[model samples]
Target: MVTTPRITPDLSTNVGALRLAFPTLMASGCYGSGEEYAPFVDLARIGGVVLKSVTRFPRLGNDAPRLVPVASGLLNAIGLQNPGIDAYLERDVAKFAERPCAVVGSVAGFSVDDYGYVTERLAARDEIDAIELNISCPNVAHEGETFACDAALAERATRAARQATTKPLIVKLSPNVTDITEIARAVEAAGGDALAVVNTVRGMAIDVERRAPMLGNVTGGLSGAAMRPIALLAVWEVAAAVRLPIVGQGGIETARDALEFLLAGASAVSIGTANFTDPRAPVAICDGLSTYLNEHGYAALRDLVGAANPTFLGTR
Candidate 1:
């Protein structure tokens, strides 16, 4: 009897200086530092784990009705609620270090100094594999405008964080900007090691009966399937504009959805809102991606990166 050989494609990839075992990461704010879903899935099997956003000080977040379900997506105004970086380092960092996967720390701030302070501290921690700067949060220092929407401000923030940390810096871009590539170029020029395109798009919903906004914050970040197309376009545009790797995410719920981002030039993909429904989604997608590569005759996962680009195919 002859047995068939099992084919395993290389799923490893790099996002800036950090190397990942796979290309599917658990998006920030989805896994909550990989504690909540530890029992449901094998966190080690996934590519990386991006923890929830933390600040220098603890945040109470928005009022009631922070998360609202929308058509094919979710609207959330969590306001970067976290227990502060000091608390996270003292309590959670040790647990995170025990995990086999790469651990990424997500930091949000109200000022440039705030970004630098948090990043400098996290960079000193050997457990943190990388730092993701969440500049999409409303900048209280800039009249409530998100730093990511302003190229100059974004560059300054990225530069401050870059100077504060030797660890790989991944800036999370906002899709609410007029032109995403402008922000992408600014980050790259400011010394960002990579980009995560993007954070959720700004959107809102109204309660017809009450005639009021469903979210207490009036507007919330739109995530899930509703934002995939926007994410794909942003990744495609940024890929053309900069030479940095990208972690493309929006509404990725399955392996095929992840494949779209890779074909558009993403070095990796992140699973976010989908985790709300399925705790095992990221791991499942990883398995499916390996299956896709083997069945499609692709030698490795990196071979699919930017495969759909005309220039890459010599058709442009």
Candidate 2:
């Protein structure tokens, strides 16, 4: 009897002080606190689960019609609607802690103090493996001017969070900037452990028949396959600028998309909007990645990271 060869590719990775069993993570806001997806996908199959951004106070989010479907993407102005940090810690943290995978808590605020407060609170929770600072939300403080839009502001925010927590800090950056590398370097210098490159791009949709906007917020963040190229560029630029690990994400929908991000310089990849289309997308990508690694004679996932870089290939 002929037997199939056992394929076991090392998919482990490290982001600063935090080590993951795999290289694919469920993006923030895509999987809530993970309870919602527990009935659908295997929560422990992926590297980590990043919870949705939680504020100091419960939010009602924007008005009606917050999500709209585009050709190759989704436009959403959900406004970070979530229960306050206290509620999350009291009700959700334990649930996530019970899981056998890494749990990454996400925090967002309107000011430095707000960021610091949330970070400090989450740092006390042993259940949380890391903290993802969401500095890219477009409808937040400073008259909707995201902290990621300015290098100085990004550094200030990172500094505040760093002082507040000893947990691994992953700063999520915005793509709506003049030079993303400046913000990336500032975050790294300010003690950020890792970076999550290319948050949803700001975009708008209209209802021609109604002569109005489609999203309630008028302008929403665009995500899905449409943002992959822009996300790749951001990862390429930021990876070249900082020595810190990167969690690249944008419109990743398959294993091939995740591979592109890794080759571009991401230590790990985050599956976002694709989760909405296929509940099993993350697990499928993980399985497919293993197959690709074995077929290509790659011993580990890290071997593929930044493989496309000219400097890494000695082609520059």
Candidate 3:
């Protein structure tokens, strides 16, 4: 008996109009400007890099003792430290043109106006292929994550940014909310082209010796293997609630971990804490995904999206 040759699996995907050669993206704040990892990994092999978030003004970030090691994850309170948007546009934006893959600029803000202003300036850069509106950074004080935790606020922030630029907008959502789906639906209605389901979960650590909080800020965002289940559930729920594409993140490491998110209905997967362990983790995941697809007689990565979730409403 003769068998037909299997075709190579197609891994390409799109976040709005921004085409990614692969479904792997370097999560914002995890991989500094793509330049930092070029020496350790092949930039062309991956999809893109979501640059560290920039605010309307420069920030000093949180104080010392910013990172704490936990049982299966890490807690951090980085506070979105970065040069102001003006300096970023003058000094940083130009360098992104040299990157081999897509460059997505991340914008963090304290108000709807901040989101709109920063997004307009960042998205206007020719080097920026897309925008990741970071409305859910829990590391910062009071207003940082408030936009994502409330449905109406989330919609207003998304709409403000949406009106600022035609660039593809990916709204990052918070897992700390009571009903994540409500916020996801609101963002979609507000014109978000895609959704980044589940940023790091809010957590804290204590110092028995000092009898004080481990993190200088007292509270931090938790990420790594411990949050995989939570992130997966958010992706599943959000995918079922909106038709936009979803980028699943939070605590992903191995190929199996990434696969779980795709099967649950994520159109793509963002690599964050995993990069801290291995810079080449993204390449490894792509290789593993190809092997799995061939073994299962699948023709493309999109075929696996939403495969395990019957209620999934997003497109593959």
Candidate 4:
């Protein structure tokens, strides 16, 4: 008898009105043009898709030496290069608006107004379901990092962004912090609806002969399997402290990886670096999770959320 992964899910539910087949989703910057990847895999199969970070204005990003290969992962200073908000709406965002799957727009800016102005522009458009704030863009300005690292500054930026739009706000926090909980709470107090934790850790590499940094930007954010444990831990800490829903992501290459985030208190999970490894990663995860659920007798994906939390690990 031939058998296949079942798309049917009884546990099809979520933290709010957002019901999902499984908690799997694609990380921002992972999936290329929706129109481009459409041939490789069904982007809509996942819970949602976070578009690459857009800015208030178009950016060409950094110089040629922007990507470097590290032992465990890839370091990138792509510089959030994208056409400004207007071109994005006319081009990328408009394309996805026709799809039934949730479209999460990711944004970045150099200053407080950069963030707020971007949000306001997105709010005026109904094409996106939510906005994922990339306060942790590691490539360009030191200012973006400043907002992400300081608790007070993080709060101020979040509050300003929150005031700009009524859309669901999800703040992506950097993993470089010693205490992620402090930043998470600040977002909650400032009215962020959800969180996408642990943005890639900052790192650098050197070219021996050139005696210069490998990446044109000198340093960049690291993403891939190497960041899994740190990402999981950060998600766990933030989830435990904040009541907001979380979209856990980083190095999620397989179904088990997605489950790890769900157990860590993430309402949904995002696939980042793995996409570079396998373009079909997100669809594979969606199908893999459905099979896991049907085999385990769980009715829906929601039932699995936090079921594997350490608090539930050793039971009599």
Runs in model 1 deviating more than 4 A are 1-5, 311-316
Top model by TM-score, which number? Answer: 3
What value of lDDT does candidate 1 attain over all alpha carbons? 0.89
Once model 4 is optimally superposed onto the true structure by TM-score, how far is the C-alpha of residue 260 displaced, in angstroms? 0.9
True-structure RMSD for candidate 4: 3.8
Task: Give the better candidate number (2 or 3) by lDDT.
Answer: 3
Instruction: Provide the TM-score for each candidate, comma-separated.
Output: 0.96, 0.95, 0.96, 0.90
lDDT of 4 at 310: 57
Q: Which candidate is the best by lDDT?
A: 3
* Backbone clashes, candidate 4: 6
lDDT of each: 0.89, 0.88, 0.91, 0.78
- Say what the RMSD of model 3 is: 1.9
Instruction: Answer with 1 or 2, whichever has the higher TM-score.
Output: 1
Mind giving the per-residue lDDT tens digits that candidate 1 earns over 97-197? 68879999998999888899999987788889999999987678789878999998999999999999889999999999889989998998999999999
Per-residue error for 124 in candidate 4, Å, reads: 1.7
Q: Candidate 4, residue 130: CA error in Å?
A: 0.6
User: What lDDT score is found at residue 241 in candidate 2?
Assistant: 85
Output the lDDT of residue 37, model 1.
82
| Winner by TM-score between candidate 4 and candidate 2 | 2
> Model 3 over residues 1-316: C-alpha lDDT tens digits?
9886877899988877889999999999999998888999999999999999999999999998889989899999998899999999999999999888989999999888899999999999999999999997432444445888988888988999999999999999989998999999999999999999878999999999999999999999999898889999999999888999999998889888999999999989999988988999999999899888888999989989999999999778
